[model samples]
Target: MTKQLILCDCLGSQSVDRAALSHATGLPCSRVHTALCTRAIDSAAKAISDGDVVIACAQEAPRFEELAAELERPAPLCVDIRDRAGWSEDGDSTAKMSALIAEARLAPPPVKTIDVTSDGLCLIIGPARVALPAAERLADTLAVTVLLLDGTEDLPLSRRYEVITGDLKRAQGSFGNFTLRLDRLRIVEPGGRGDFSLTAPRDGAETLCDLILDLSGTTPLFPAPHKRDGYLRADPGSATAIAEAVFEIAQMVGTFEKTLFLTLEEHLCAHSRAGQVGCTRCLDICPTGAFSPAGDSVTVDPMICAGCGACSSLCPSGAIKYDAPPVAHLIARIRTLSEAFRAAGGSAPHLLVHDEDHGAEMIALSARFGRGLPADVIPLAVPALAGFGHAEILAALASGFAGVDILPSPRSERDPITYEIALAAAMGAGDRVALLDVDTPDAMSDALYAQTSSAADSATDIAPVLLMGDRRQVARLAARTLMPQQDTPVPLPVGAPYGAVLVDGDKCTLCLSCVSLCPSGALLDNPDLPQLRFQEDACLQCGICATICPESAITLEPRFDPTDAAMSQRVLNEEEPFCCIECGAAFGVKSTVEKIVATLAGKHAMFSGNGTERLIQMCDDCRIKAQYHKDNNPMASRERPRVRTTEDYFGQRRDH
Candidate 1:
């Protein structure tokens, strides 16, 4: 029997899932209970044997950091859960608990920052001391005025350092223009407690605003070590609740910047095999390009990375690791379940399910469709189908499951090729199936069985597949399946809408651009088209579609009239495709393209003699030629372009 140790009550949620733990490893409930009541990490660590699963819920009440620090030593399959107590018993708890368990199983921090910066200058003393070079490089690269104050160091020969004297007076103006009162200059070191002033460049405000916008204009940074910006405001409560919110935002932004990165490292080394390398999918999916591999090594640019685990789910080699329990852990549990079934003279097949926001639908579908199967089919909830999906597939194959099935949202089908390969591989392995849960008027169970049969002719017996669906739909589908033909009907909408644009059946090519570009969870392409819904209320009306839509298929109606659904339908349905005169390919819908072209044309007309249409007509090379000729002309003035008071289509510029 597999050994299991669970330490609970320390966390807000389950330290170990008694049912899942028992089902997977064949460990007795008594042993699991014993582990749960244990207080110290050492006792639990001693109790767990080789390849055993040990789960600890490190709640903040008892100082989670101290508990985590105490458990810094190595153990087999030790899962450390963060903020377990406050988590719901079911629903999102699995993913949350699993991730927490994964993180708890890790090591500790080694890196230290000498200083932290605010507005491009060192905001703190310690960070400033060690990060002198980094700050200097940033200043040079950005062409901004950076001041480094030192307490002990002498006036440097280098021009970068401006000596600080106590006699120097302080001069202050608005952002750019300021005259110094400096009669006394004092050289203050970075780590010194002395106060200093940092003046931005003339256009520094513009650059800083642009940078902030480019990074996280909407989302806030969390777990304010020093200070939080954007959305991460600090309120002291239980550490678990605070940590959960911080990590959620961290996962969303992809980085915690300082302490979290150290925690991530400790978590990785702790979980890694003694000789073998653990996964690094977390590093791979980082959108900020913060995490980089350096010759069998990994490095993170904290400045760049937001600590989002987008990379964690996308890493193909499993090189990236999350502080959260990976789907791999759950898959391992499933394998154990398969073994348990065999031990009990059962021949149940396992079905692993993945979804973004919900997993109940898959569970409900299993109860509805998994009738008379050889053994109980399992549904494993996964946050991302990318990294977790692949790991689960491998786990199933190893565990002797008949085949693996992948159920993804309609939006997940954006790249059909990737999904196809994943599904085909699972099918190629044996009894793998791929199904899209399109909320429709048809019975999906029969359709799934038929498709399963056709996909695998060699299989004499075929089990009906499960559907991974939206949160509400999953509930309704579950109710309907459990109580068939009953009048307690959960009225399902034809399609869910995100933001203003409802995916018109005719217009939606299933390209999934809107879902991909949506910064908010306003649009979801889960389960595939027709069934995919959009939440119109969440849309920011940014008109990102007008900017990036390749097909011109998507349009933003600035003024949405809810009274006329038909009018909206007509907008999407009746819109004509516009072909670019330069490249015959359809660029966008005619109206959107015309509007964009007109805006560009007007802007260029003010600066260049050539019209915007002519600029469009000119290729990159031709445009360069025109610019060169314009620049070389004797009449060319060096003066900046004048901003007009008159409002064009958008708005008039305010002259400074």
Candidate 2:
């Protein structure tokens, strides 16, 4: 059943802070301000329902116009406790103070009463039941010499205060609701000067009212999905059922105004940076551009958002917190578990082994090496081959686990830079780390066997091992060879080997060793079939696929073949070439420049360094101008055809 989601927040010194409220409701502070600034246009009677109260905690006052509109239908009450001058016109003044004092005390005209000055203590509370305790604290502070004498009751009780007559006479009314009517009340002057009588409030109710009216007590609330309270229940189906359930649990709840689900335009503008107004990252990458910006806030077009959870995962500022478990919840779990795994196993030279193909090698390593060199070798297992790389690894870093051994198959389309980052992280934590290059099962098994033998013979310092290898098929081989009696293949999830390239059927041979070379989990093999799923999204298109495709079966499909724009540049030449510049000097490989220009030129326009840093050294001008012309302005030189000639090949001056 669809439940009515009520977002509630109390405006008092306790709980309900601004950040917590924003995080809980997934609404921007500005929008919340808009609601507050307009004042609660709708009445509590109109905005409340039997089953739902979506109490959105506002950073500022609610917009009166918008509140009235929200109140028209569902009667969603917008409560605005005047935090920080709802309008700002109510400044501190004496006339207003005298009027408020007269009203609250019910005293006759201009009766002078001074504070029996002791310490100017303040206590604040809200109308809610939880606020009474805070109110009582204020009474205690005011009665410095006097003590609080009351039973364990929720209601207010009478109390008396000790004061000095001389100090009380000096105190005078400063503003509305602030009065200095009593003269002999100052018990002990606050730690300041003796002459000045001005100070903050010292009464119980007045203290709370002052805090409430000034918006000082307003706090952001972070109401985690209260599963026990039934605020958030398991899905039963329609929105109606969910709403009904929520109403039953939280009576007198105020539902969200339908306008909260803003238009696509509104959502975009609100979410983007101020200067980059109308930026639509959600629209561009979101499978469904179901989000838009409203003013300075982004809102979800609930109908189109599909609750896919992608927007939440990719959002830079975490503006869009999702309710789904697939991404956000999984990400949190991965981080938590990865940390536990690392802490429990990070001592010895450890490798974080992944990939199903290396199951045999891991088993051999376990039998031969034993518990991974007597250290932690975290085997992050997953159902899908590439699923673990998305956010699990990231979470591991966040959880204080810096070192990781990436073990991928040679044939798997793994990226080295990805592993470099992991290695960097490990290095950052001062851990001995290594990316074990074992893509194929056989290679991995052999490598482990060799390592085991070497480890036994030598007294060498075995560095902390971060094994990144693919041990899928090797594990099967080990299971079959080592244990002939056993019928099942070793579970691939447990330190399975993977390769750079994998072949399903005879379309391609699983002979490529690129997977083993991959330092990161950029590429992984599918354990079920001989199939290989290239996470092209993760692949930098480094031509490692073409470099290690042993069978010549895998080719960098041209534009027409793949038809995907992201793969367009993958069609460039995979091989390098030696070219003679001006005086017959082989300046390095020509294809290297071509590759760099193709892949990174347009994308990394802002990179101050030249692409020549990786492979070869281009002439100073070529390197500098290459970035300026190609990266800085690809379209600027449309008049000149980008033609390759002898001079261009030789890195010499070309005729205009």
lDDT of 2: 0.32
Candidates' TM-scores? 0.30, 0.20
Give the 10-residue window scoring lowest on summed lDDT in candidate 1.
207-216
Instruction: List candidate 2 segments past 4 Å from native.
Output: 1-275, 278-314, 321-375, 381-402, 405-656
**For candidate 1, lDDT tens digit of each residue in 370-471?**
421112233444544543433344345445454555555543422432432343342223335454454521233343444434543332132322323321
lDDT of 2 by residue, 1-656 (tens): 12222222223222233443333333332223223223432332233423333333333224423444555634333322222112112222112111111122221122122222213332121232323433333443332222112222222332332212222222112111223333222233334533323233343211211111111122311112221111123232344543443334223122221111212223312232333332244554454445555645666545333333334333322344433223333334334333333332222222254554454345434433332222222344332222233133333433333344456544332443243334233212223234566544344445543443343211112222222212211112212222223332222121111212223334344432544432222345543323344533233223445455566565432110111332222222122333433233344345545556567654664432654343233554454555556644654664676878877776664442
Tell me the RMSD of model 1 versus the true structure: 22.5
Candidate 2 worst ten-residue window by lDDT: 206-215
Candidate 2: count the clashes: 138
User: What's the CA error at residue 414 for candidate 2, in Å?
Assistant: 8.4
